[model samples]
Target: MVRAGFLLSIFLSMALVPASARASDPDPWFGHDKFLHFSVSNGLAAGGYAVSSLFWEGRTERLIAGGSFSLALGAAKELYDMTGRGDPSWRDFTWDVIGTATGLALAWGIDELFFRSDARKPVEAAATPGGLAIRW
Candidate 1:
């Protein structure tokens, strides 16, 4: 996740700011490119971190795993935009990671709120779906 975030950050903050999306716009953020950049970066980072936390600690290995996933997701998103009518840019990748990182924080906060007492499990685990059960 960290690696992905880093790559996305670079793509958005540097790669696309002055190049791509010159005549394009993002849906959620509208014409605000900065918003897109941060959103993507945090989203990808957080998502990767969340997935890794499912099977590993938030250590180096876990972080790396998350980063790798983030990178792949970022690539996929770019590819999606490329094939679609949307404008694809490196900056978009940056925003994805920012969004991912934000998601990670959100996930951690949720775990703390719903499963602070439960170790090595998701916050909501009725075994229904979203996360781990609280009672096991």
Candidate 2:
């Protein structure tokens, strides 16, 4: 039940982000914000995976699924941007992948760092307290 709800929420939220954006088309990009975006997205992806795989027990599989989903979703988003309502920026897609990876790393690092005193320390861990023994 919990896992279903989280999956539904994340997928739906992604769909909702640009219902109309998909109708149009996006242009390309010039500047770059790779590390920052990748890091944030990585953290977010990890957290998102934790939530979606609440019923699962294995950590490796959950991470792989999460990573696969993130990559596919990022590519899909880029495709949508090109065909539908976003810009045709392959660069952005690349960054999206990078970000997702970074976000996952950050989430893990945070968990390892501050998962003791306050569960809220790790952004990703905070998002999904499934395996965490967070006091709060």
Candidate 3:
């Protein structure tokens, strides 16, 4: 009987503790965090796009890969923040998405404006007796 009563009291206390610990005030630095999230996501997206462009021939493929990487990184950070120290905010995620899009657009614009003409044209591959040969 004593053990049962003790366990019941412990459960009641655990439930009530969280209710009292809830804060009534808003965070002071909420706006700054959104900007930080945007800048970090933007830089990450631009870097991902730049590196992927070096390996991918198709523009659509490179954009998709870069965007996916950037969004995944943001999601990972948000999930990590949810553990204890920080709460996940959808507003910050919205900024991250916007920043990633901006970064991708910038990368595409730079590539199209400056590097398009510098690329070597691809040559058609010819099928030979033993294998296919490609000329650039």
Candidate 4:
């Protein structure tokens, strides 16, 4: 379904990283720059979700908005790097994707736990002559 397609697209995008970028990346996966990319992307994704929530009622829509916003910025940064301003590294983009997913999941969890208006209402219980009756 839609989930399968989404996952496939993610994997395909990762696979599409240019060979030149991969070959020229002298950066370590655990470098400080990678940490920065991860943290910043995480924050951006969460913030995007938070902002999108004000206008969208659907969880899927919010998630898409947040993820797309974060990933677009990550792609933009890599494209900028490719323009000779900095070293372009697909590893950085990979960290960005990981961070974006983490942030979106965290935000979705928080929204479900605390902000969901469609959550079930509290059950009511009444004592009957023979037993307790509950109404949802």
* Candidate whose TM-score is highest: 4
Identify the runs in model 3 with alpha carbons over 4 angstroms from their true place: 1-30, 117-136
Alpha-carbon TM-score of each model against the true structure: 0.43, 0.49, 0.63, 0.71
Q: Which stretches of model 4 miss by more than 4 angstroms?
A: 1-25, 122-134
Compared with the true structure, all predictions reach lDDT values of 0.66, 0.64, 0.82, 0.92
Tens-place lDDT per residue, model 1, 1-136, is 9999999898889976778658554444434765856666566666766677679754445556656777677778789889986678877776666666666666667656765543555445456477645663
lDDT of 4 by residue, 64-96 (tens): 999999999999999999999999999999999
Q: Report lDDT (Cα) of residue 3, candidate 1.
A: 100
lDDT, candidate 4, residue 68?
Answer: 97
Which stretch of 10 consecutive residues in model 3 shows the poorest summed lDDT?
24-33
Model 1 residue 110 distance off true place after TM-score fit, in angstroms: 11
- Residues 1-136 of candidate 2: C-alpha lDDT, one tens digit per residue: 9999999999999988887567533333435444544554676688766665565555456567667767777777667878869565667777778777766666556645654334335543244456655433
Index of the highest-lDDT prediction: 4
lDDT of 2 at 32: 43
Deviation of model 1 at 50, angstroms = 3.0
TM for candidate 2 is 0.49
Query: Which parts of model 2 have CA positions greater than 4 angstroms off?
Result: 1-40, 111-136
Better of 1 and 2 by lDDT: 1
The superposed Cα distance between candidate 4 and the true structure at residue 2, in angstroms, equals: 65
